[model samples]
Target: MEASDARVVYVHGNGNKVREDLLKSQWDTALFGADMGAATRMAYWAPLRYPAPLSDAGEDPIDGGPGGPVGFEAPDAPAAEPPDAFIARTLAEARLDATLGGAEGLVPSAPGATGDPAEAEAALGEWLRDMTYLGDTLAEGESANTVPGSDAGLEALPLPRAARTAVFRLLVEHTFKDVHGYFFGGAGPAMREVFTRALDAVAVPDGGALVVLSHSLGTIIAYEALRERPRDVDLLVTVGSPLAITEIRDILLQPPAVPAGVAAWCNASDPRDLVALDHTLRPEYAPVELVTDHLVTNDSGNHHGIREYLSTRPVRDPVRAVFDGLASGQTQ
Candidate 1:
């Protein structure tokens, strides 16, 4: 896919572009003495929101043909309820304040999950299983595989793979679910409305192939988006993606968005980084092709330097594979 042909949507994680101070401070803590300018430039990309009505309850389905799936499914529709309910449950479990913290509580809405709160609640419990550090704790009671910058002696680090993946999951959840209630409350309906509007604004013209290059939490968002709208996605490349986080894989309760279409995914990670430890991006779903890329680098700049790892050989190879896969139409 030509760079211009592909509509590479860079979905940022956790904070907003307008909220630069907060974003910088959070990043500073993670990187630890790293150059702020470089990290910001490499990580910061595009904001995916656009103007739209905040609440669409009883409103006509916003056109998803252009933007994607903001209002793709009908309200009170059976298919739409599961994701919504799931999001509501997630917020409740995290004990988050949905609107204040800018967290996405649910997929469609964080409130009712179509109409089945009980089912949604159950699913939410399963999903939270992967968010905690215990998710990575082995039954055998063995120590976790170490990743660079993962020394608990310093900051009580989470299992590298689980940490990044859980962070990604929560960040994505923040985009849609309300965070305040003990178990479920205000979902980020406005943010979903914005995302739907933005995708509609930048509608992929001519059915040309589009490739999404994501890192860390961005990767999780991309995966969920694909799960919701697989028809719109062509190539998905995740670098330092924590898809393998035990809780994320175990808990999130939605089915594949694109169940039949063949979408290519390229997952790249560094063995020693700890964030992608034992799990980053391993293709488990069908009709979605996965090609693994190892961001082969030492433990020196581990977890915090995902953007830095992009220049290394392992990371580049799978990126090339994505391009190559698009060209050849087959190769893992």
Candidate 2:
């Protein structure tokens, strides 16, 4: 059960990424501080969403390459919002423009209206309350009053208020686009095929462990793929995942449970990662006793980058232990 015999398969999350080999190399370095060489493989799904790999000239914006923001940035023309009502509701809930009519369904009184002063005052009071609620939601995680299907509202993120809102919007737009594409846009089969092929490509010797590490939207892909086509996975680690979101869980293979072939499941998230707003899987996935959740501080500006998650001790330790034959029960 040496590290060399254990194989790791990584599935990336949403957004355009660098070339496949480079992406794999970056992950290897992040997890182990050196190239794992043949010990690891990546299920590269970015090409399915982005027609081309990000240029090597430091233009990669998804994971904060040289020219991009420290973390993520929305593309020049962000993908149109998907048609899902849940997504629309989340966006409307997070919108900061008060003049617009959608912020908690409160519309500002008409400009310079001669309406009754009492009515106007009541409307203003309601608007102020809604704004305060939005601020509170961001400051403290999701409020108990959050809509049933909505994501955990954005946290008191490190970025400026405006930047945080923009990032949240972008994350939502990209996440739903990718999630919707795989589940509803006929991309599921192809993406799952890529994952299955990657898993198959890794050659694990007898008694050797196979770990599946998935992030963000990739977690959804890995989960569905493994459910449809089970594999003997020693450990399934999901980071910055959206699996707990009600809408996402609803679309997953019914009667959710740990994939039959998976021995242990660990879910990790940064408290500030909007994509992984829910931060736990045990509550939703069955055989809940087998699922473990870990909270790690992701120093990356947006707090959801794969490198940040992978490098965290809480995440990397279990993977290392499994590979080293030291892991028992649930390593996390």
Which candidate has the highest lDDT of all? 2
Worst 10 residues of 2 by lDDT: 99-108
What are the per-residue Cα lDDT tens digits for candidate 1 across 1-332?
A: 32223344443433223333443433333323332332222223224332332232312111111221221222333321233343343345443222223433332233323423344334434443432223223212322322211211111223333223333334344322212221133233333333344345454546345545555555555565555555455655565554565544554336432223335554555432323444433335443324333333321212224334444444444344434445464332
What TM-score against the true fold does each predicted structure earn? 0.43, 0.69
Model 2 regions lying over 4 Å from their true place: 1-3, 57-60, 64-171, 326-332
lDDT of each: 0.37, 0.64
What would the per-residue lDDT of candidate 2 be over residues 1-332, giving only the tens digit for each residue?
A: 33447899999987788899998998999998888888899999888888888776544444433344322332332222122322333334344332122222112233444434334334433433443344333333323221112333332222322333333334445444576678767898899899999998888887678999998889988999999988999889899887875445656765678998888887777654567655667767877766777656564534466897888766787788776663333243
* RMSD score of candidate 2 (Å): 10.7
Query: Ten-residue segment with the worst summed lDDT in candidate 1?
Result: 60-69
